[model samples]
Target chain A: MPDTLFKPRMNADIKRRSYYSKFIFNSHFLIFLTIAGGVFLYSLLGLLQTLESSIWLDMIAALLMSMLLLPGYRSLLKPADGIFLLPYETRMDAYFKDAGRYSLMLGISKVITGAVVALLILTVGHDTFVISLFLLLSLLHYIANFHINKRAINTQISRIGMTPVLFIVNILSLMLVLQHPAWLVLSLILLFAMGKYVKRREHRYLDWNAYIEHEEVQLNRYYRNVSMFTNVSHLEKQFKRRKYLDPLLWKPKGASFNKEKMYEFLFYRTFARDHDLPMIILRLIILFGIIMVWMGNIYLSVVIGLFGIYVIVLQMSQIYSAQAYLLWPKVWPVDRTFIQRSYVTYSHKSVFVISLIFGIIFAAIHPALFYIAVVFPVWGYLTNRIFSRTVYKKEQELSD
Target chain B: MVLQIEHLTGGYSKTPVIHDVSLNINKGEIVGLIGLNGAGKSTTIKHILGLLRPHSGEIRVDGITIGENAEDYRRHLAYIPETPVLYEELTLKEHIQMTAMAYGIGEETALERAGDLLKIFRLDTKINMFPTHFSKGMKQKVMLVCAFLARPDLYIIDEPFLGLDPLGIDSLIDLMVEERNGGRSILMSTHILATAEKYCDRFAIIDNGKMVAEGSLDALRDEFNMHGASLDEVYLKITGGGIDNA
Candidate 1:
């Protein structure tokens, strides 16, 4: 019965993968990949041209090998599995075996990709035997690292504890790879024995909560990545208060305000407290500012300024739907139009401030960009007006 | 009547989950909406709260329909959903303050009511704590506090007893009774039939999106031809042994 239960869950995961793949293969994602691929190829070519020694190449290979060793087990276990399937714990060997095999395959593919990249970088004027030995040793390191991660999970080791262990293993693997090949095989066998021992130990307890939590973290990571390109409705939001930014929300103490003013304060606080939105906006502004300063091109600065505003507006618009799930806001005595107006006002103010900062930075960088600075506030106001009438209107309609 | 729903037919989509459901709550009346899951008790309440529009009939609070004036209609009622829906970003104190502001309650009145309700719910100490730090029952208490602080003419509570400790449950009942005696009406949906029987002035039993039986305990007993039947027994019989097909 437990084995049968695995089939539906596996099928659901497959369906999720297929749905995500469809989105990943969409035109926007494909275009992004094409551009990224071009940049990567250009950089790789530049690195190959600057190749100084085999030892430097080996160091890079060691770093890439360590990154590939990071452990991730995608069991797709849900919280309810702990309760609903507790009775069938003894019979869950086949289920776990299948899950382990799936994860192992994924880990192997990643290692293979890393090895291929390493080979491409190391192959120039290098011995075929040395390159083969390097590939073989890296594979062994991957297997050992994967098993160590499994043991860590079974033992409930914190990631902080696992990090030094990973570092030690990576150093050892690099040393062994740089030495005789026989040591690599011996280390691989030792790792395998340790893995078998840990596997046996873990079989004694279900540890359903830990496995479910791991799977949820893994799923959230995938969802978060996918959501950057397109909307993923089922993705759960993770929030942080960002206490260091508390001064940004400074207001006069004991200030009395009406409901509309209170709403404006709430909107500001919501943006400040969100874990990702504020950071994303700040990062974009900084990145664009750096580019403007470096290039000192007024045209590029204006474009970057507009792009910054666009990005800020796009992310800030999420505030409209932020409180949509709560019944209190919807059922409150405040008019719905008031809420809409508050959102619009908040968006306009945020965009205006961001644009003003960008404009000042650009003006400071290149005096010729002073006109761009003056134009940004007006542009921000107009963009926000249009956004509230159009995009915001559509969002309201869709939510309704 | 504080709340009046006349032949309401509404649900998530065009196909109604609740059909022709009609109920009314007079001033100071505590009406229990009793049913198994998916018996449309929540749907009826949703229609009353104006969260869901009725397919055909009209729902009026203080004789004003939601379509006629949404803000006025919402101002007259306070709703506690089956599950707590708190603002993740807001602290407990902020939630109450925001609720008060939204309801147009004066600052002094809001502070007094908030202080009393927080003390009663035993959440005064966690006043500055965020909802993320709260336990399930603590979150429910926060919702209860916010609702009570609103001081609306009608209270729409769904599954209010869930996740509440025995003491918390007793406090909730005490509050409901106090509100009723203050001439505020309540329409509560619950599966805890015994408690509902004790507190409710009338009971409305629904099954399969329609009303199966309704009235006071004596009236329900007389209607079902089971003299002195308890609310739970009456409910089980009406919902066909309460199998919870939903």
Candidate 2:
């Protein structure tokens, strides 16, 4: 029965991805991806042309490839399975074997991608034989490493402690293999020893609770990544108490704190304490700023500024979508229209702030075109005005 | 009447879970919406709260229908659900503040009332903590604190005694009586008849998504021809009689 469950679960996961992929790869995101990828490739090729053959290239390739090792273990196991499947633990070997095969396929795809990315720089000094040997060894190590990760979850081993140890070993193994094909034997031996360590520490039964929590974390990480491109209705929002920012957060005074402005207050708090929204905005500004400065093109900066506002405004819409669907809002004494109006008020201000960051970056890039800064905030306000209505339309449809 | 539900027939979908469920609560009354599991207790309450639209009839609070003026209608009532639903990002204190803001209460007055309720529920020290991470009972107390802070004309509480400890239930019953004495009304739904019988001024018993009986304990006993029967016995008799009749 457990083995029969795995196929449907994997198919459902794939179907969910396919559903979200439509919105994630929509025209806006595709355009952004094209320009961003083009710029990154251009810069990388330019930098590579300036470099000569050296250990730094080998170290860089090794580091990047090592980072991709230890691919995540996704069992697709839910929290309730711990209770429901506990009595059937003795018959779970086939179920787990299927899960191992699924996870290995996922890890191998990443290993192939890493090898392709590393090959760009690895070709400088190393011949084809040396590179092939190192890549082959890395793939083998990853297969071994994934089993260690899976077994560690079943044992009393601390996962956090095991990660860095494996990471360093991965880096060392690759570097050694790059130096000589003979070192592949040493890498295999090390991998064997680690497997023995986990086998020795294995629990009598599976740790259902730990694996379930691990799966949830991986699921949330996937949602968080997808949320950057489009709203994820199923995302489990994580909040942080940034107490130091409370002084900066506006306090509603006198008349402004009434029923009409209640949602406005919540909207602001939602944006501020969200574990990702604030940081995502900051990271985008810095990243786009670096690219604009490096390219030093006036037209591109304009395009970048406007597009940054558009992306951040799209992100801000998630905050409204999050709040509107909550139970309290449906039951609150405030009028239903207050939320849309409050969202408009909150989002316009938020977008303006984000636009200001873009504008400032643009101004610093092109000091001669300081007046162009005005267009960014104005464009941000207009984008929010038009975009938030579509969100309200969607929310209204859901509620109706 | 503080609340009047007349011939309400509604459900989550086209099919109605509740059938012509008529009920009423006058000022200063504590009415127990008594029912078994899946007996439309929650559906009736949802209709009263305007969460689910009635398929046929109307629900009124303070003589105002939700369609006529939703803000005015909702302003008169506050709801505490069976399971505590909290803003994951907001602190306990902020929850009360949100209720006050939504109800248009002054900040100082809201906090003043919240302080008394918090002390009664023994949640004053945890006011700064996020109620989302609270234990089940404590989270229920946070719901209570938020609802009571609004001081609305009607309080719609669903299974108020489910998650509470004995002391917490005592505090809740005391608060309900206090609110009743102050001329406010409460409509609480629960299957725990023993707890309901102690404090409720009246009872509305629903069985199989229908209002099987409604009245005072004496009126119920007289109607059912069970003299001096306990509420649990009377409820079982009413609901069980339906099973036999079918």
Candidate 3:
């Protein structure tokens, strides 16, 4: 067999490409990026002007050391991979070795970037010896950390025990390099020896489950970050039932139930139980609320409030499409039109509630913007109507 | 006929897995679809459930083709997939209620049937628990309950015995028989030859995307010249004989 392990990675890359093509080229993304870039430049210039060289060096060292804690391999091992790929374990050694090299290259770039940032802040005459020594120590720390992590995968050493020890050692090695460069070579030799010892002592059995779990965590983290920008097709969402939010989904006892009513209830419960939709709405509201209060520009705040509502509405609309992947919905006896109507109705209610809160917060911050309380609901209703119509039209095309 | 599949040929993609296969189940009849793994059992089931469009054939439920009236056709059939597919967030009771709502089952009827099925499967006590933490067998039981609760005119069940406990299996057979006696039809696919032989009114044996033989046990015995042979023997002889002949 040809190395089939790359198939999953290839599929993921295809999904990622489609996702970016749909969202990254949009005007909303461009606007968001422009605002973010402006904020980042403002912060960077201020930090360079105010922070001292010593503090910058300390921060860089801490950051570079922390980066070493990340895993040094991307096995891309999914759950099914255990059964499918475990049979070819002996042949997979080369694949894993390549993954380790790739991870090390990524780590090197992160360390170099941090070091360059520190150099820019320390613009005055800097010690060449110290800089070179820091780079060498950082490289050694990365290699040693990678070996330790690989060993921990199949070894008696608990990750809880090994992680702290490795972190302290990495930090101490860097500190020694800065203060006393002569002792740096000795520390590197000792770290390399320890890494070799760990490798030699570790059990040979492959823990495919742990590897798959680790890879999934890494992949999920990447997908979750990308999901903030656009919908990710393969991201498995986490679900949580917030009991305190139950009252929000409650219906009166002995209430009459119909197809539409049941659909409405189901949609409500799905939204409340899902970890992403509700959290995304709350995050946008809080972020906009803080920016509005901090900037205290009534016009700008109102504009942002409107834009925030738009973004939330767009994201919330994803719930309607989400159920399409499920079987029960497609197999349900109810007409597709009724299902669409229920989705539109429930989404409108959710958006209205969210926009009302945004309006209340904006009014509280700037009493002059009290008109937002009225304007927000009207705008939300109109947007919901327009978005729902577009969504339904697209769905109609797909079904046809 | 409650269910009719005419010259159905389809798969995941353009290339067909099950080719030109035809089968039917009449009212109050139970038909067993028996085949080995990757022998197009699931592909056939998928065609019947309207999950996959037939490459070049038609499937009908209650005399209405899936393409002619998708919603109405779906309403007439209840499907139990080989692997249990349940929403992780929904409790056991919620699953049954959702199925009831989807099928438009009356509240009183739903309540009565759900109560009885839950008790029969010994899942009554766990009605409030989410299936997220359910064992494999428990999850299968939940799927069984969902399908049973639908009470549709036709039940398309695929490999219903896997991951089910012995008692759960017995309860399922009993419920399926009860449904059949009540004038509902069932088309079940399984690798469990003995169980299928015991419960099925007739058997349709498929191989390499083709139906090799389909009839009552006596008819199959007569055709294969395996007089008095068990269903298992007949299956092995047919498939093994095909390989040898090929």
Compute the TM-score of each model's chain A versus the native chain A and list the values: 0.75, 0.92, 0.73
> Candidate 1: where are CA atoms >4 Å away?
A1-11, A21-33, A54-58, A83-97, A104-129, A175-201, A241-247, A250-264, A275-319, A337-339, A348-400, B13-15, B106-108, B212-246
Residue lDDT tens for model 1, A1-400: 7787667887888798789889557874465457545555676777788776566677777678778866577776789999998999889889877777667775677777787777777765467887787777666667666666655566655757666666666756665665556667666665676566556656358678778887888888777656543446676766676656656773313435457756776788788887666777788788768766754557656766765675566566666665554566678887766677777777888888888998799789777547758877887788777666665466578657
Tens digits of per-residue lDDT, candidate 3, A1-400, equal 4265565565675576576767755887677657645664566667667756674465565456555544455666669878977778778876676566655664576566666655554343247777676776776677778867876776666767877777777776776666668878877786877788788877777878878877787678767656665556677877785667766674312335556566676778788888777787788899978876765667666767777787777777666666655777667777777768888779888888988988898889878658756777777888878877877787678654
Order of quality (TM-score): 2, 1, 3
The candidate that wins on TM-score is: 2
Any idea what lDDT model 1 has? Answer: 0.77
Give the clashing pairs for model 1: none
Models, CA RMSD each:
4.5, 2.1, 4.9
Top-DockQ structure, candidate number: 2
Q: In candidate 2, what are the lDDT values of residues B9-46, reduced to their tens digit? A: 99999999999989999999999998777889999988
Prediction 3 global C-alpha lDDT = 0.76
- Model 3 chain A: lowest-lDDT 10 consecutive positions: A250-259
Per-residue CA lDDT of candidate 3, range B1-246, in tens? 888788888898889988889888899999999887778888888888777878888888999997788779988988888888888666777777777777877666787899998899888999878776689888888888888888899998888899998998999999999999999989999989899999999998899888888998889999999999999999998888456434
Better of 2 and 3 by lDDT: 2
Between candidates 1 and 2, the one scoring higher on lDDT is 2
Which of the two candidates, 2 or 3, achieves a greater TM-score against the reference? Answer: 2
Give the distance in Å from residue B16's predicted Cα in candidate 1 to where it truly belongs. 3.8
Look at candidate 3 and give me any clashing residue pairs.
none
